[model samples]
Target chain A: MAQKQINGTTIDVNDEGYMTNHSQWNKVIAATIAEEEGITLTPAHWRVLDFIDHDFQEKGVVPGMRRMNKVGGIPTKDLYELFPNGPIKKAAKISGYPKPASCV
Target chain B: MTGSQPISKVSIVVSRGSLEGIYPGLIMANGARMEGIEANLFFTFFGLYGVLKNYNDKIRVATVGNPAMRVPSAKGLPMPTLLGAIPGMSAIATWMMNKEMEKIDIPPIPEFLEMIHDAGAGIYACKATVDMFHLTKDDFIPQMDKVLTVGEFYEQSAGGQIIFT
Candidate 1:
């Protein structure tokens, strides 16, 4: 674990750069972290983040790619385009949650 | 993110037709794409059954001659080989396996292929095996990208880690 100051706010991040504390997550921090990953947050990107948070609130677990496709209504192809590279990992990093663990 | 990527891609070879044999390759291919690594599945020999539209779902667990067939609750008791050799035992085992997998969020054969392909992994059938089995592209599911010859498969998998299951 480590401390990061993003947009003048102190936040805690894990070894892989994911936010360890959900309370410190905000739009500014999310964007900053995403910038490090070479992503520019678009409306499509925010849509996924919002869906992820909404799903997390209801499911109590970070939705994996399968869940995002089946329940969150975002196809894996589009999610890949929106977050590029590893969409699951990138989305979790920007959304301030531990990466989802899944094989489906 | 790490300083450098170690495994950028993987080439998985599936040669077994049984439910147990096919799933490991599918799971690995799916896991590869989930991590943003390029992945391709090569279905050869009896493994071709996994992608066949008429055969994929019909595949069952290999119980006969399988040394691992044993009772769980009873502990260390061999599920008598003759019992496994019975007509419906393999089906029963396959059903039990599917139920357990569902509880952990694993999709069924056809649906799992869709998920893997939708995640940008390439699914292919081996050409030699196709010829030996007298099968055509029409026999395969829509998710299969193409049927590749051994040489072509090797060329396509250039620079990727190769695994067999």
Candidate 2:
């Protein structure tokens, strides 16, 4: 086994080069998450984050699909263009969806 | 609306007295969509006129009450209804708005409206006011969800904070 250094964290990599620690999944990496989803973090994305923060402040929970759909101000095509995979699913995941299973 | 959801949800109520007021709602709603936030706009009273296909063309913002407006020809001039009839008032207003928005890097109104619609923000007109004003579905913009009563608006606004600007 060869040890590799990533962000000051050492990980054992086998011939396959996969990190040895499954616990890494439990960590929150906002930048990595954004990169993984291909989000460029424009003021446009900040607008979404701000709205989500405001919604959470007033409502005490993240909105549901119905509300999300109603708030659907962003074009789905644009969203797909922005996120590629899916803005909603990726956003929900990054925001820590109320229930992960239902989120995806 | 999601309880504990981030205040990131953007809802705007259009109830301004001037053409200027109407544009903010339109711009913000459209901006919200572009940024990936959910946007909802409620057009009430005179604001409904902006969304009316026929009246939309006829709508004008009253400069009389706007402190920001300067009447070069005369001070304290009430926006003569006739001024609204000037052939280019709408175009002028659109131009001014587009210019100001460009200063802040915002897109133009038509593109903004399209983005807002494509993003999924539900646009609604006030049912009671629409009826009171003697307007019908035929008078409204093509994509309006429906004419909603205050009660209906409240139902929609239940989880989200309501903004009346």
Candidate 3:
């Protein structure tokens, strides 16, 4: 797929409205969460997608790394290991949450 | 733009310095709710003390080793631990933080937690942090939904963006 840079953040909108850069970690987070919950998905991508969707329903926003760690059973300390670019920002982008202005 | 869909969810992670670090998570969670977003706060390490019922009001601003204090606002600040030993320091700090927040119309921590909860934001205390501090479930504030380990929180956050404040 072709990629374009928008204000330094990559924007890739597919037919399903999915943003590509965030998809990988989203999948990992989702799978971990699903495995923990005893829920199974035939397609790997479904795990992360559904997990984020469920979390949104429960909390009304994409959760950060610590919450993800809580929900996915991943260790917070291991976040940097999971996402080289800083877990919070990377995972958040994939989770469909914009960075808070104060963060910048 | 994502087609005018409201910001429906946000997740914040709290693990750092002192009351200042913890307060932002609470403030953001509440702020998100006000913006029609559901928010969640995950408190770990030093951040856990903020949500601990016994320690909530007992939290003291960190005067030492605080990068924030190196700036103009914190020049000549007294030591927080030392000040904690002194009477009224917590009240003074609370008053100062409240005063500053009030100027911006942000409510206090207790009020913020209330708002966040009412908006469906979940607040959890990090079990590892609790264990490290030798604290029990009863030590946490009433706002807490549960005591969770890091792995447990991850299960909850799953596909959501997870942040560490």
Candidate 4:
């Protein structure tokens, strides 16, 4: 575990810089993390993150990319376009969720 | 941490059409794309069964002559090769494997290929095999990028790990 400064607040993070404590997350922190991944937050980006929130709150685990596309109402291509390389990992990090355990 | 830069690219060659053979290569290529690694799939010989339009659904596990064939319902107990030669045993094995995978929500071969393609992985069919099998471009899933020669595969695979299965 590591502590990272995002939006001037110290937060718990993992070795990969993914936030470990969801309670410490906020929109500003998300935007800051997304910035480090070379992306700026957009409504489209929030849509994906919102999907993640709803799913995580209900399931207690981050949804896989397939479920994100099939159930989250976002196509895989659009997801890749929004988050670019390693969309699932990047989006999960920005959404203040742990790194996904999915291999898909 | 291994004193080498994290892998940035990968090229996978799959030459097996059986369920046991093709899935590992597909999984690795998909995993590469999921990690932001540049990735592509090169299908030659029987591996083309995975990419070809006519054969994907026909891909089955080989029960005969497979040393590791087992009775899945019996906790990995090995099955005799002679029993493996029973008619329809191959289909049974494939069905069981698919059932097991679906428990984890893994998609079928064709849909998995589409997912990999959507992840920005290049899916290629081998030109020599296509010619030998007399397969036209129309005979493959629309997701296939191109029919590549061995030279082109090597060219695309350059600067990264080349995994052959």
Candidate 5:
């Protein structure tokens, strides 16, 4: 486990820098995390992040990319364009969700 | 950026038409997207079956000359390649593989493509293969991004890891 200080607030993160505590996630923290990934927060990005957060709270699992496109209504191409390197995991991390069990 | 090396992107080349060969590329490309890596799949040669509208769903496991085909329940017993040459053997193998995949929730080829596309993986067909086969743009699934030449694929995949599946 690791710790990251964002906006002067400390949060626990996994070794890969994904925030381990979902309660510590906020828009400010998400923005800081996105900045670390070289991304500036945008409405589209927030849309995916919000969807992931809400879905995780309800389902206890981050939605897969297929579900993200179908349910979140964000197109697959748009996700890649927004997240760049890795969409699902990056979105999960930004939303303060644990890494998906299926991702490696 | 967090003191960890990032996999910026990955390009997978699918050059086989058999169900077994094609799935590896599809699964890997989808996996890359899931991990937040940019993924591109280039279909060339017989691999175009994966993108062809009519054949994508009809791909079968290649049993003939495939020494690695195993009877799943037989537990490591290899199916003789000679027996695979019999009529309807390929279809049987394909059916068994599809059934096994369904047990684990893997979707059919068409749905799989839709899933991967929705996951933000780029699917491209080989321009030369399309031309050689007289395939038009409309011959591919709607999710296919483009028919790219080998050079164009290399250009787009610059600085990214390339995998031949």
Candidate 6:
């Protein structure tokens, strides 16, 4: 467990930088985290984040990449372009969710 | 490639062509990509079926002698080896496997490979196998990166974990 200071507020994050407490997430924190990852928040990025947040709320589990592409309406190519390091895992971390259990 | 350097890559060798054998490599390679680790899948021997443009779509589970094969609905009962030897049993087993995978949103072979490729995983075919089977470059899926010798694969996999499936 580690703590990260986002937008002047201290929050707990897992080793991979995913926010441990969903309640602690806010737009400002999202933006800050994105900046740390060398990305500037865009409407497209927000679309993914919003979808992740909504899906997690409804399903109580992080959606798989296939679901993200088929259901979230984001294609795999765009997902890679948006989050270059690791699309699904990075998106989950950026969206303040736990690392997907199915991901290696 | 210092020993102290953190492991950032993996090379998965897929040697079996059966649906059951191939999926493990695909799943593991996909999982590695999702973890932000560089993944390379080397399809050799029968495993080359997974990357072949034509055969990938038609691969079947080898039910005979597969002790792990279980009836999908019968949780405690194992599929009898003799039953597996009967005609059409392979098809039935394959259909059941597909149905099970579908329930969990696992894509079919072609689609799964495409997804992994799109996710930045490298897909390769073994040169020796390709030559022995009379397969040309065009015989592979468009995502196939290259056909390499085992030595070449080892060179590329230097300092990374090697997973055999």
| Top candidate (TM-score) | 4
Find the candidate with the highest DockQ and give its number. 4
Report chain B TM per candidate.
Answer: 0.93, 0.72, 0.75, 0.95, 0.93, 0.92
Please, what are the lDDT tens digits per residue for candidate 6 over residues A24-84? 9888888888888877889999999999999999999888888888889987878888987
Model 5, span A64-102: residue lDDT tens? 766676678888778878987677778888888988776
**Candidate 4 residues B1-165, lDDT tens each?**
477789999999999989888999989988888788999899999999999886797789898888766687746889999989889998899888899887776778998999899889999999999999999999999999999999999999999989999
TM-score between candidate 3 and the true structure? 0.50
What tens-digit string does per-residue lDDT give for candidate 2 at B1-165?
Answer: 557765556668997535676777876675555445666889898787667774564445454434444333334455554565577765665556556555544443434444456667789998878878898888877767788888888887665657787
Runs in model 6 deviating more than 4 A are A1-4, A10-16, B1-6, B72-74
Give the fraction of reference interface contacts each candidate recovers.
0.64, 0.09, 0.00, 0.67, 0.61, 0.64
| Number of the top-ranking candidate, with lDDT as the measure | 4
Q: The CA-based lDDT of model 5 is what?
A: 0.85
How much is the lDDT of residue A69 in candidate 2?
39
Q: Which regions in candidate 2 have their CA more than 4 angstroms from the true location?
A: A1-35, A38-76, A80-104, B1-5, B57-59, B71-95, B102-110
Binned by DockQ into CAPRI classes (incorrect, acceptable, medium, high), candidate 3 is incorrect
TM-score, A chain, model 6: 0.92
Compose the digit string of candidate 5's lDDT tens values, residues B66-98. Answer: 776677554667988888889998998889889
lDDT of 1 by residue, A1-104 (tens): 79999867999988888888999999989899999999999998998999888887887777876678788888888998888778888998899988786656
Q: Which residue pairs collide in model 1, if any? A: none
TM-score of chain A of each: 0.93, 0.48, 0.41, 0.96, 0.93, 0.92
Superior candidate under DockQ, 1 versus 2: 1
- Compared with the true structure, what per-residue lDDT tens digits does model 4 show for residues A1-104? 79988657999998899888899999999999999999999999999999999999999988887788788989888888999878888999999999999777
Q: Least lDDT summed over 10 consecutive residues: which range in candidate 2 chain B?
A: B65-74
TM-score of chain A of 3: 0.41
